[model samples]
Target: MNVCIEDCTPRSASVFSRSNLRLESTLQELSLYDFQVDLDQVGMVLAKMFETNPTIPGVILNHDSQFIGMISRRRFLEHLSRPYGRELFLPRSIRALYKLSQVELLILPGDTLIVDAARLAIMRSPEQIYEPIIVQISETDYRLLDTQQLLIFQSFIHQLATELLQEQTQSQLMQTEKLASLGQMVAGVAHEIRNPVGCIVGNTHCLTQYYEDIMQLINAYEQELITPRPSIEELKEDIDWEFLKNDGLQMLKSIQVSSEQLKHLVNSLRTFSHMENKQRRETDIHECLDSTLIILKNRLKVGIDVIKSYGNLPKFLGYSGLLSQVFMNLLANAIDALEETANHSHNTAKIWISTHVADSCPSQLRSLIIPPKNNPEYPQNTESSEDPLTPNSQYIVIRITDNGPGIPKEIQNRIFDNFFTTKSAEKGTGLGLAISHQIIYEKHGGCLHLLSTPGIGTEFEIVLPLI
Candidate 1:
């Protein structure tokens, strides 16, 4: 039977022989009667067809041989007992049946590349029925491949499937990385918003208290002056108009102070949130650091000293707002760590910040360095460079070190990961280092990493390229 089937295989000669055979070879064959049959009848026809010609696994079901839908013997049997099988088998039309089958099918030309044809076959998944057959169609002819061509076609289809699966896996990994970065950004924004909100709430509370006290004083004056009594001199003595004026003036001053505090809180929020625009200019690293220090000076704890070790650094193109954020996180972290240590003993806490010119070498920075790419996150360089540094050369190295208990070894590796925090949930959002990492890596094509010892202290270093 195998030999006979091999001898009867559709070869080039038989494929191109008579006009009818050529037409069959070129066009996908269909039978209207088979498509009109009930599920049982269709199954019988499929079984008989497969029994007679084992290689022919699928058939085109049409009303008049004009392509309507495809039926696969293997798929029909596999889904025969499934929950949706009864509904699928009762499809009223060939198109309905094809939709129920969930199989893909497409006809191909005789000269189509094996690779391309295989991709379409896998995408269509016409093979489980009987190694999906591609019918070659021409204006007046059609052809089906012989056994040799069928084997080659099947091999190519499998290869395409493997390649597609690999590509999907890699795409998923990239998406995961992007999502992780986004999570960090969300947390950082939340943390940065908390301080301004707290300030607003506290000032409003103080204003409410002052208003209550003024209302009480006014009520007392009204009771003394407008009470049901006929003592005009007593009322005049109780009024104390001069004292009321002075007290009223003081209350107004208090309200003004509260209002100003609320305004300052709002301004800080606007400044931090609108940093994207402020950082777009070619900014000096020295100036950015100094400005951040000035703004955060009041927040520093008593006896906490700051030391600057700025070197001859060139102006680099950066977003001042983002750079300020980086400085703020680092400075805040340093202060927090120092304060925690100072609680143990009265050793004066110190934070050291330094910026210096550096050579463009990956070895100089421990983290993976990505040079700035053109995107919404980082500004593209449009201005012609007149400086000695190449567009990708001359990086600024900013190191922030503090004298405090260094990070634990186990958590150091995950310091920059999203939502990884060592501090209490209320104290830290675990996004500070993560955002700093993204700003340095994604936005600036820079690097942020830690150098620390558990007992001594921790240092965070950032490197940004100057163009």
Candidate 2:
């Protein structure tokens, strides 16, 4: 007898990309078994079709061009192997055998997720667990999927998730090491500078006293000019003593002012160098922010103004060094955004920084701050919004807002993802905001959120509980 396998399109021909498949991949991406046969055909004909396509997992059954059900190869062969089964059923219609021994069929939509499909497939009775799945592609189209193939793809997705997690952890560790190294270097440099600045300040004071004594002697000489000799007058006029005497004091005063400025800068640098500290201290938030600004002084352009409204906050018990790092990242990003559109913005960039206790904030902004559950050991908040680690304790809110070209709405959702960046590789590692988010959310048991409107501006709001 001549028989042909109809509609035997292997799903493998329609490739599902391994690299592109993620945790949310659907069953539509998998290769399906689309071999179907008429239910009215005799069992011998169905057996011949299976023989023609030995690799097919199962056959979709239809009557009058309408989907009725399906029968897997394993089930069909088992039925045929029964005593006198071929003698009784082979010559009979496939519908006769199908009716006599039919098992429950598991059907899923084409859009069903791969992982979810696997779960549903495994829930079947042990006897029907390996049976082929009926996937309805549309009202008029249906197909079969091998349970083994579904589990394989789910395993691939599981492996991908694990690798991504490891990558993120390694990146965060490297970032923490880099910040510690930077803090140590800055502290050493600040220490070296303080000694020289102190010497200049101390010597300037001694020099001021000596200059006064010398001026006194010169005035005394002028007063005791009893002779008023012509040669003496000529010497004083040639030396221009009056101009020298006045300019000398002015020069000494200028030196003192410059030395004082140097000392202030050194102090700021030392404050920021706390990044290497492993212990949490009684940190002053305003001081930490001011030190960060001082470190970024060179980047803060003349046109870029930093307006700060610091609320009256008591000392916070936290890791100031890491918090300062987070502040630096957010501020630096704001500066870079402003600089990117400097020409278009016409040097009108401004950053507004505000800090306030969560309870003291206005009703609108207060809801955004969620207090941590525990006082001393608050756990990190995951990506889930419904189960935030909220407590009744007080919290602090820090907002860093910038008036610049805002982030595009499409890419904003992925801004905090690790190694994701729009800037060139040399300009950005894409880790600045990611590491900052980690420091605020995971390390400090807080939350970091970005609010932006295209062409308007962007703001990074950090909410930390006062633990």
Best-fitting candidate, scored by TM-score: 2
TM-score of every candidate relative to the true structure:
0.40, 0.74
Candidate 2 segments exceeding 4 Å error = 1-31, 62-69, 78-89, 92-120, 123-128, 134-143, 204-258, 275-278, 358-392, 407-422, 441-445
- The Cα local distance difference test for each model comes to 0.59, 0.81
Cα lDDT of model 2 by residue, 1-467, tens digit: 32234446564523656877888889877778777778888899878777878878888888877889988889889889999999988898888888866889999999999889999999999999999999999996888898988888888888988898788679768876886788799889999999999999889988988998999998898789877889878887999978988999999988988887788788878877766346677889998999889878889955799999999888888888788878988999899899998888765799999998875324344344333322233333433453233556577889999998999999887787677788887888888877777677667767787788989899989888775
lDDT of each residue in 1-467, candidate 1, tens digit only = 00112222243323532333221122232110121222323344544555665654455454433344456656656665688765655333334445567555555766555555555555543354244454545542323333245445345445555675577557546655664565456446646766766665676667666766877897697788765455755665689755765686576667667665545544443334334633456766776677667657676746789999989987777776677778888998888888887879666788999888877645435333322332244333322242122444777889999889998988776777555678897887666777777777666766676888998888988878765
Error of 1 at 359 (Å): 2.6
Give the range where candidate 2 is weakest over 10 consecutive residues by summed lDDT: 371-380
Output the TM-score of candidate 1.
0.40
What is candidate 1's CA lDDT for residue 388?
23
